[model samples]
Target: MKPAKNSPRARIVRYTVFGAISLAVAVITAFGYLRYEQRVDAMHPALTGIALQMRHDPAAWTRQERDASEMLRDIREEKVAAIGVSRDAILVSTQTGAKYFVTDHNGAFSNALLLGEMKAGADAPYQLVWLPDANLQTGMARWAAAFDKIRDLITLLMPLMLIGGLFWFMRREMTGGAQLLEESPTLRFEDVIGAGEAKAALADVQSYLTDPARFTDMGVRAPCGILMTGGPGVGKTRLAQALAGECGASFISITGSYFSAKYYGVGIQKVKHLFELARKNSPTVIFIDEADGLGKRTDTGGGPAEAESNRIVNQLLAEMDGFASNQGVIVVAATNHPENLDEALRRPGRFDRTVQVRLPDLEDRAEILRFYAAKLTSKADDIDFGQLARLTTGLSPATLAMIVNQAGLVARKAGASTITAAHFIEAIKIARIGDVSGAERALSEEERTRIAVHEAGHGLVAALLGTGVLEEITILPRGGALGVALVTKAQDKHLYRETEMRNEIQVLLGGRNAELLVFSEASSGAAQDLQEASRIGLDMVSKFGFNVDGNLFSLAALPAQYAGLQLKNAIEHANVLLRELDDACQALLRANEPVLRAIAERLLESETVSGETVEQLIREHAAASSPSMHLAQEPAAA
Candidate 1:
């Protein structure tokens, strides 16, 4: 396995290697200069005398020298002492007084010593030596001469080294576009929390992958692609990983959005490259998270981004159903919006199977809670899984895991050794709504009482209507709401009848209804309630056609020409229906005024009340009105 270059250990090693190279280069260069200086010092005396003459008269040295520059170039690398002009011939001498002829003297003498001149200078030598300035012939100049060959060697090697390095980098990038995780995936199906149907479907796929020969013998080809559709935080990506792990295959994961680009053909090239990587690593799982982005419906309208997206989609389709079959490669894609995906990508030869990873139900929630809680070192048995499951009705498996983590944090904050039920309750509240204890304390007593009355109203109405199981009623300010009555459905409901819809609207307006019944006026606390109630009313009339006397006209499908008028008439009819529901809510609250009063009183005393306490109060109120109910029942029997 290659260590990431950005990892601390890798970075430290890289820096150490670079430093060592630099230090070695510096040492070698220093040693070369020192050796050159030692050689120059051996000819110091002769060089000193020549330098004095050159400084006094430079004209005599270079004036008769027609090839002075060439002579300097040729001798810079050589150790020479002096040079002189003897009539038309130039003479050179080393430090030992040995003479050498320079220039063309009688046709055949260049840097050649003259034996007769040595004897002539033995008695009384009369020689005028011409020399250049010592400034141009020592220290740096000497070192340059000593290291000239080494410098040439380095210069010659540099281009070859650069070319080799470039080739290696390009090769690494081209072949390593996606990491080939040689190790089998560690995630297993048991590691996943919910989505039982998705898990079962993926288990079958894993069987096909793990036993390819068995499938082939049965004349069955494995599905080329699988598309997991779900909302965010529903573990679509995790399911894909679990599939790979179950089959013990190499998992190459990438995001679909990564293939999109502003350039024309870059998207297409990247898509092809990704598939090629998968093929190279056979029996690979190519998991694309957020696949809808790359495989979106390709429309006829043209733009740079749209055209690029279309090209990426086309490339992906071709790779899935191309000429060669990808027998060993399985493409698993995840998307939150499967409806936005291209139809061609979902065809039989491509992603034939679409699995829905829906939100966890009560039992799933409890299982998810236990799964996460068991991973901790704290005491998990003290926490009631049944209550938690009922409380967290609509939470996804991801959110449930977070709740368990937050529970641990709460316990640690209070210096507890084990997470208890109180910690879980507090964590659940904090997860659903923000921690608002400080904000609650900021409110005056009058404001607190008003919030208590508001939340109590919602709780009473919800209990009366049997809309859902009431979890908790609290006066604490949370997430910009003055108060909240948390209700979770007893079970998941796919469709709603007209009675349930109307009851839900009534419960929403109950807070305002309570304020009017008790204080003879409503407060700004009911603003959110009114907004929610209005949205439901609009949806009921426009989207579902619950109003308009069973005409069954879908407002969403209305013609543009008459849409405005139709919508106005529908809303007007819905408003009349809302007025009737509001009256019904107020009448119901009045008939059960004693129940509402008792719950509001208990809330004001405690600032919060449990669901069980509310239920007990409702039973007591019903018992107190039994006589009137018996009298009404007698009239019905007669």
Candidate 2:
């Protein structure tokens, strides 16, 4: 029976036959061309100068005949049989049918003349002709024939090989291109840290996946899809996996870029295949990480890439919305840039719910640190999770985990049996800034002194103003900075008062002010300090309504239509506030020159001074300067 044309078996048979025919035709044509070349070469030998030389002068003919006779003597004892010189050429033929032709320059001999000469060669008007050995000539001809056959065979097989390779690759892509993870996730909520609210939000989806029949009977459909939006390393993907684990469902994971293919329609096919897999494995969580790869579509026409992206997104939407039954399949997608996702994918019925996974806060960071620390062989009491959490404000859970692991590494490198607080501190420094220990040894004495002065100035001003708890002051270069003054709040503060903002600006400018007071001129080392101080000043004027003019209205809060003159006034006011703050910082540095000098001197000796030591220096200076004044007790570690 004849098979259908589009069937896989039929297609394979057709391709095989076509490839075989093409290969056969190629071999035949190549062999025929080679044979024709060989025949042409035999008819007209490449070397023709010997015949021309013989015909050029009759006086030299006897000498040439003697030379040709000697040449024949070297060829395995083959004798000179005959010489046939035509009008245009002289021909020498070997017994093995190899012919050599040499041209005659003069018109002294014709073909008929040569034939007559050959017939009368035994007695009249004959010349000696060189003939090659029959055995050697036969062996060379056989090698040439073998080489030609090999070349023809390669030419024959090339097309077939290419076709077969293409067929195999296409079949593989059709059958197993889209990877699906059939195993259920092993990551439970207990295994995950941070994203507490996101976990709470996904609890409903977990319930639905766990018991789809209960929801189906009550006419309440499970959420078709969940979209997770967050910054990178905030645990959106972890949350999705945890949801899968919570319900003991099969997990199929793929990135948004998985639907992208070089060929058209392939992405759409992948989307269809992905959905089919999810359906086959009911109670499955299909996690698509980096969903922004689908891209936001436009109404205006674009290139082929844009069109393909649109088609894939459309197919995904269709699959999500066209499911015949709930089937306990939940489509979960995570994107760092949710705004870059297609609007169609974010529609109500399609995504059904959106969860935001934000950076871990202080308590959450502490929790994450504790979780990772428990996995390490460490002195548990030596590691201060609260202080580490306070220092790592705005850090993600991933970063917190890294801090723990890096601490373990640092401890091991130092030949310590267990991790310690000092190791965690070093790890935090590495994570926050980078390894600065090597860079510290490279600094010259002058640069070290300058850096020490700059960092001491920052630490002193922050402590004096009570802006926050002074953590550490170091002249060790970190990242782009030549020095650093680490500060942390006793607790996370979501709102700041105007005085607190101003005090923060003053601390930022203290480094530059200290430079001016000590060196009689400020260096360019305070460029970052100045920039940060300016930003805070501008925010106070335009955003926070803390302008010196007491204008309750925020310039940034105004619409663009009304911001022409108001924007300029806000900027002018910000500059005035910066000048005022700068003067205050200079005066403060001048007044506390003795304490600043003490801190900078200590730093120059140690390269790094603890915040408590800096605070102690300030307290001692205050007490000595004013005997009757009362000093506040030292603040506890954050």
Candidate 3:
């Protein structure tokens, strides 16, 4: 509804316009007063002497003296033209022939009470003239110039068209429509390939938003907060933004990190103010990115920072748990480290529903790559997802996009008209390690052979393992690595089997073993591989109960109570497992020693291989049961 015409806000717009006009008139009038009174030229005795003499002998005065009086009168009118009525001042006539009432007046400038009293008792014995409503005439003439200027300005502004737009804009802001959220593109369900459970959860929420009344009588309470928790680049933010678009609610986004301030309570105050603003416009969704900043655990013995942050979290908790349901106010917070959030804040009253956003599956990756490549030119008919997906194993959606963009850049730089499979292939190789252009790290020939063979060994092992896990092998170093071998899960299966975990560890070790056998020593190049493999093995023993040596029959995921705890527990767990972890890694390596050596031998031939190569190897030596199968089948062929 349009705002009522008499409302304070509407009046404010009108008053503001009037006040501005009043100020302008006051300035012009002051200028006129200064011009008339400040100069003191008209008030000079020499200038007035002609008028004094003319008054002494009314009929005997010369034409020059009369002209002087006329000039003085004209000057007085000019001074009055500039004077605003707000301040007290004297008034006079412009010409001798016209009466004071017939004289010109300034427009709209208020006439003053003191003006008449001063003119009536002027003490001019010789010229006894009492003017009627002369003050009103003077004010009208003085302010007329101001009105004329405003009218001219209004005419000029009409052409600019900003007046109407600004009026509507201010009215819209005053009324509440300006606070309405704008439309954003919502991703189709097809865009999100993994997290079926999370999708179902989101779907339910969508349904709730569509028909809140339907759930109202069902005794269901809308979730106050939907906590999207996952590793980085897993698309938590994209999904929430999609939800915002889907619901058509006001979307206000702020990062927890942006709340920092020198004052202890300033962040808390800002948080309250923001929430209040959001609530004032109900049916709003506030998305806080990286909420760990405000939600970090408070029990840690940090300084005053923890105490202040706790206050901020406390305010947020209150806001979430307030009387309003999700129908009125909904909050979606995304954080990579959900484990770092405070415990109290994660309870049901706060973030009632926690959605786990896991990595995308192969199909999802293919879709994501296709989505990103939509704008790029196809390099050749060889640009196949079958090969691309296999090559880009374990890459996040974001990483996949970067690879595609970089591939396009490579195609452009090479002066290729169309992006081809070779560009994608090169992009994948580069993504695995990173670009090594000019001043790129120069490895020794021996180191290069070792890295290439190590990656090849891993690829071969993954492909030869019963189900064939190896996706690709690259000598390109990416993300703090010399080279990497990628292994993909057959499907994006969340739960891992002991055998799969064991195979993954073995695959991780394949590179180190390949380097050791080929180069006779492992360099820091194996640092990342060893770190990953060790962590997996350690988790198997500590949390997953895969090791059977310690805490069997236990699910290692965070307990409901301790879900959003801090990093301290994770660190302590790593430390405790440290005492018993080394032996497990050593045992797994020892059992796979022969197999690793055999795989390394095969890798030494090619230095790198693809899933297709591994498949071909197994197909060529079908009778062979592992790398041993190749050897056993090999003797028959020989």
Candidate 4:
């Protein structure tokens, strides 16, 4: 039996690529020609400048005398064929095989070595012919006579030549030219992770695409469209393409941006062209990435430009709702902001199936990290995949991939065969923020002591709390801070209890508390730390109503009731909130000082402490006379 045949859309893509390549080659050739012409023009100026200088010279003869002399010279005629100019300022007639040079007396000199000589014409001898006073004037006159014809020839041919090449390139670009069907793309189902719930939701879509006849038999219309909505970077585009590839359907991918045109009818024309192309290639999936850009909601009061956008969108709606859409054509569109899309486009018959792509859960995150990790060099075999995944609490798959690549580079540089767990830990930190460009600083002995003590206070408290809240405390600078203590939970949770919120506030204030005890005044280095801690602590007391004092009652209700009103209220609330935040923040840092002081005194003696060291100290210290592992993640500004 023969193998399955190749798909049509694949053929279109292959041809399109070929056309683009041909166009690229033609453009390169044109550029080369232009450059050559420029160089020739650059050199022409020297000869032209010389001629201009000669014509404008004070010693030049009158026009009538020059013209009469030039006519007389021409009327004298050659022996047979016209003589051409040659090197040594001589003229050679090929027919007569004779050479003549212009003598000082304005007469032809035969066999005159002193004057100049030209060999019988074997080359373009006209190039070197000299011009006497009369000949020079006549030679310059010929240029004006010939300019019209030469320029017309160039003008007529150049654009036609360009168009011909562009047409040929487009033709080639739209053809397949024997593209292998097997290599269309695999898009294995598993490459898509975390959206398993989404995948599960969309399972029926495959049945609809593959067996539309089943619905036809039941006298029902199949879904001709599916919408994938998700946050940015959640792989909505990837899912659509993968599905098309997996189903072996013809995939014609174009951006929604491509459909929005400034010209009145152009957008509608493109839409018509796209759907026509889709209909011609049945079982085709038109994947428009970010379709909201094209099919935005129609506002009656919108301007002319928005009207143009709406027109294209209406055309798209017609194509989808019309009989053509149900005839083996499926349109899959992805957008982060689905709410912004025009309602007509996403109506029941149009974008009938909505698939929501979301961030992968923890297990999914682990799988994604593991897949990327496999490509990295000698990553430790038992490097705690679960633990690493847990540490990357809110990280996305894309971010995870970047982390693995960065750590692999670090491993490569260290001459280490395997990427150690430590390497990934560092990569995670680097990825979370940016590079630790200012990590190493010339710290005074006093500054180091203060920093060591401050960080220790945060690390010690979390260690003591056993909240799984503080993950790691590294003295190494990362991000804007010179040092940091990161907190994460093993499992991802959307909601935080009041206690969890307070614990976070405590961690933020830990450094400030330690600072006040170590130095008489709190360092401004804890500015961000204080700000963050104060806001949360204040919000808890005032807004969230989670505090003991009824000072929280002084706060107003939440803002976002009406659209414009919300923004105005939010601004006003921000001012009052700032004051509450400042008071609560100061009070928290001040109240926590006694406990923080003891922790800092211990940390001041210690140079660097990891999670392990913090835990050890937590075990060793018991409240006032007790040891604490809690440290504020606040590091000195880099």
Maximum-TM-score candidate: 2
* Clashes per candidate, residues 3 or more apart or on different chains: 0, 2, 20, 28
RMSD per candidate (Å) reads 16.8, 12.1, 16.0, 18.8
lDDT accuracy of residue 96 in candidate 3: 43
lDDT agreement with native, every candidate: 0.77, 0.78, 0.62, 0.63
Look at candidate 4 and tell me the lDDT of residue 4: 35
Q: Write the per-residue lDDT of candidate 4 for residues 436-528, one digit (tens) a residue.
A: 765457667677667766786666555555557566565555667766767668688878787777666666666766666557667777888
Compose the digit string of candidate 2's lDDT tens values, residues 290-342.
98988877766688888888887888888888755547789899998888888
Candidate 2, position 494, lDDT: 78
Q: Candidates 1 and 2: which is better by lDDT?
A: 2
Q: Write the per-residue lDDT of candidate 1 for residues 1-638, one digit (tens) a residue.
A: 88997999999999999999999999999999999988866644353465445445544443233343444443454445656543334545445544444344332332343222455437312333433222222224447666997899989999999999978865544333567667877888888877889998787688878988887889777788898998888898888888888888889987777776544676676777777877877788988898877657457756777777776787778888853458789989999887778888888889969899999878888888888888876667677888888878778888888999999999899999888888888888888886765687788987887888788899999988999998889887777777889987877778999899999999999999998998889999898888889889888887887875775777789688878878777778778778989999999999988888888888888878988899999898889799888998998899
Q: How do the predictions measure up, each by TM-score? A: 0.72, 0.74, 0.57, 0.67
- Pick by lDDT: which candidate is best? 2
Q: Model 1 misses residue 455 by how many Å?
A: 1.0
- Candidate 3 residue-pair clash tally: 20
TM-score of 1: 0.72
**TM-score of decoy 4:** 0.67
- Candidate 4's error at 377, in angstroms? 2.7
